[model samples]
Target: MAKSNQTKSKEETGASRGRKGDRADEIVTAAFEEFTVKGYAGTRLEDVAARAKVSKGLPYLYFKTKEELFKAVVRSVLTPAFDEMRDLMLASDLPSEDFLKGPFLAFLQDLVKSRRMLIARLLISEGHKHPELTRFYYDHVVSKGIAALRAFIDRGVERGELKPTGLHDFPQLLVAPALMAVIWRSLFEAHAHLDTDEFLKTHINLVADAITTGNRGHETS
Candidate 1:
């Protein structure tokens, strides 16, 4: 009888774990869509579970609350960008001009291509009401991004290839325009017949020109 009970316990444990895994994946997917469409306050766990085709109680099995689930979604969406940015920052031995232009453009391109653009905008729009969510993004996403950009900019200044502006604001100045462009395209330009690639290239060139110093445009091959 004891052996039969032990076997039953093991089977139940495995089934519970499988259910937990499935529920976690479902909740993450649902959270992504809900956050993108409804923003933080507008989203609820019951709604997410319904979208995921699971019981409303199922999401709580994976995520204790909506806030926790949102954080998980933010982390999931932002991790790839953070990894790419980290790699670009680490590969600093490349020419400063190429270093600045190459990764920055690639980053913008990825942002344009990603679904997270919508999620990011939603978070930004409703950030004040969900201070913890905003704070999580600040601590995880924004701080890391700013640090990487600052390191690159500081290197450019040291190499004499770029002008040294106030480092505090320099990081934002370098990236904000690109971010705004993403927002505009995602929110408005979908209906307009705009040449996105051309616009991106033009914007990148303009930004690079503004930051680059000296007569030698021959810095990078």
Candidate 2:
């Protein structure tokens, strides 16, 4: 009887933790929607709780404040996907041109399609006003992304696949078009429908052409 009770207690605790995790995920998803639509300054915990279909006070139980919740939203949504991409960039033996044209390009396209882009736009427009958000985003997303891309570029140069030019020192240049796409889609899509797929593909090819030694003939002296 004692052994059976102990097993039952362990199962109950596990189930309780699972339910808490599920609730947290629901809250985070709802928070993402709210933040995307409302912006950080405009979003409220009560609104997020309502969107999550939970009591107003419940969000505070999980997150002490809106800033903390916003951080949680990024951590849950964007960080894991980016970390996977970074890890792939670090580990893959694929040539830099192929990697950029293939997996890296695909990742950027998918990012434009996801809520991550919405939040990214939000960060750009509002992050300056909120130092915490700016710092968190930089520390968690921007710095790591730049480092990973730099490493990837360095590897490409070492492999003789990419020219040892100033471009290798500035990986952000490669991704600038993606950020422009995100902003344009949000601000001008109705006026001018951006062909995101075609645009990103073209951007990837341009980067590949600019960096890859095989295309050096295309460059001017």
Candidate 3:
């Protein structure tokens, strides 16, 4: 009977975890919809609960606060993207130019396919008002991105694949154009349609030109 009880307990534990995982996913998905529509400053936890169809207290059970929920939403959207990027960084036995033209390019391409782009637009729109959210975003997303870029740039410089530039120290510059493109797409795409693929190609060309020691052909395609 003791052995049978242990088996029951193990089954219950696994089932509980499965339910929690489902609830967490529902909460994050609901939070994303609300946060995108209302922005961080304007969204309410109550609304997230409603959209999730969970009890009013269920969100609190999963996330301590709205900011934490927002972070979870960002994480759910970004973890896969950055996981791919981090893995790419790890396997980067390539030149800086090729790195940019390859894995970095792949990340940018994936960016357009995910909800991280929406989260990014929220960060731009409400980040000043919610400094904590901005800080969290930078601490998790921006900092990792910059660190990866810095390492790549450093390696490029050491191997003479790239010219010595300020970007080696401040790799944040590499992400600026991508952010600008996201912002433009969020705000003005409806007003004046812009070709995102062309924009990304030009941006990559400009960055590659700035970093490459010799004349390089633009091949973002």
TM-score for all models, in order of appearance? 0.80, 0.93, 0.89
lDDT of 1 by residue, 1-221 (tens): 99999999999999999988777877898889988888788889999999999988888877898889988887777777776777767675665667656776677766766787777787668877878887898888888888878877777777777777774366777667667767777677867755555666677677677777853443555
lDDT for model 2: 0.89
Clashes found in each candidate (C-alpha, N, C closer than 3 A): 0, 0, 0
Candidate with maximal TM-score: 2
lDDT of each: 0.76, 0.89, 0.81
* Of candidates 3 and 1, the better by TM-score: 3
Kindly indicate the candidate among 1 and 2 with the higher TM-score: 2
lDDT of 3 by residue, 109-198 (tens): 668645678888888877888899889888887888777778777777777778888987778777776777787788888899877666
Q: Give the CA lDDT, 0 to 100, for residue 123 in model 3.
A: 81
Q: Which candidate model has the greater TM-score, 2 or 3?
A: 2
Q: Candidate 1 clash total? A: 0
Name model 1 segments beyond 4 Å from true: 1-19, 213-221
Q: By summed lDDT, which 10 consecutive residues of candidate 1 come out lowest?
A: 212-221
